[model samples]
Target: MSDVTVPPAPEGLPYVSVVVPVHNDTARLRLCLQALAAQDYPADRFEVWVVDNNSDDDPRPALPEDERFQLLRERRRGSYAARNRALPHARGEVFAFTDSDCLPHPDWLSSGVRALLREPRPDAVGGAIRIFFDHGTVPTSGPEHFEAINEFRQRKYVEEWSFAATANLFVDAPVLSRLGGFDATLQSGGDLDFGTRLGRAGGRLIYDDDTVVDHPARSTWRELGRKTVRVANGIADRSAHLGRRDALARAVNEGSGAVTIWLKVWRRNEPAPRRAVEKVRYAAAFAYVRLLRTGVHLGRFTRGR
Candidate 1:
């Protein structure tokens, strides 16, 4: 947690293009668009591109009528593809990314732009993501608690893994153009792959806690399980280029790691009786998702063989 004082953005701040990829999540997209519309950043300096990623329920009708917002359609199924489709039309010097389900803080754009313009500026910046339950709701389910604890570790992704989730990421336009955008083939882990590629290309990616977004936590066991499966499939996809032996070894390592995490969770201290019960539920949910992920990867390995 570096304590760097960011100066206030100048009146003539560099133009920023905010890109959001949406599928069938029109409800959340509306909220996301509303937040973007209300950003504290100058409306004249920032533009929003909402790329609808082939949703059966069209999101265009819900888009704001203001000139600052543009609705684009990407017939491609994946989010990365949708983003790529919108990239060519972006007019800003700096590009920011967030999912349709995420609500950016009022100062998100200002904070990100200010950080990018700071001395010894970073090539790309990853922002913070905080998980919140649905509107007018509290965390009442095991999956919700599990998500509350495990969702989008953005800081760790930036500092430890040298990557950032697209849920709250920013990159210079030229750098993004040089990198040729994300791998449209990857349904998941594309953000990690893109960040890794950027770093390997001598680009610096730093974590900024000031730029924040709120993501809705998974509310049910089924949603959590489905997301786990998608993650496992993404891991498998990434390993497709690896030797079979190495892929199997990686799967084994991940499966064992899950068990280790479960054990650690079991040993964690729970101060209150209610918290103890919630802890047990969270552990159970984690164990299930982990096992599900492992099984999916193993299946992928076998199918490849």
Candidate 2:
């Protein structure tokens, strides 16, 4: 079937397990739950699994008292680990992954499942994500602007790198089991690693621009800083199996390239000075992330020295 509006079927629909991993971000998680609850998909065909990854406070109370939603906790302290905790318990033909802070479209599940059920079925599907700001029409802060230009380019990631962010990804349940699920050691970029493995295993991956979700942008420098550190550390962890030096070099180069990439794709038609200001904001954020990555690699390399 082509990418068209998929209608709800009365019977023969496959079961779906929607998995989410959340930390202390309760406010946004509430919205995410509401979105899931409002899905157009039949309740009996889909189940929601919200795995709390050792939040500072138990998120059980946050979960609505509904049988369709189950509360699972993973003390291992990572989103991927929390997801793994739900893997064995997930009783579905398809596994849908989304972030705790994401507001998936009402048709998200139906569209994803429809794509998977096509004649030449895909092993995985990467959906579209729209980055949203809490206040103002445009980004109000440096972090928000930086994220606006850099984050949630899921389309580019899927088409160029053959990987999809877990914020809106769907995969056949058996494919995940065959690949041994996500690498639990990674705190970030787990989606990329998992998707790359799928590609290498000759698994068919599809990019569906119609399947959509909304993710809130980071509004504060501190929030962006924390994310930068987490991602950099994840890169360090992944480099342990692959050569650390090579990965570290790649990270450094990617950071430098981010500056140029932003300039080329950003508002170029604007007055030169205004465009320059935007470039500065993007450069500052990219520099901070680069420095954090360097520190992480140095720390990992000099462990006992």
Q: Which candidate is the best by lDDT?
A: 1
Worst 10-residue stretch by lDDT in candidate 1? 1-10
Write model 2 residue lDDT over 124-146, tens digit each, in one string.
Answer: 99999999887956776667777
Model 2 lDDT, residue 264, Cα: 51
Looking at model 2, report the run of 10 residues with the lowest lDDT sum.
Answer: 1-10
User: Model-by-model lDDT, in order?
Assistant: 0.84, 0.82
Best candidate, TM-score: 1
lDDT of 1 at 227: 89
Any runs in candidate 2 off by more than 4 Å, and if so which? 1-10, 241-276
Collision pairs in model 1 = none
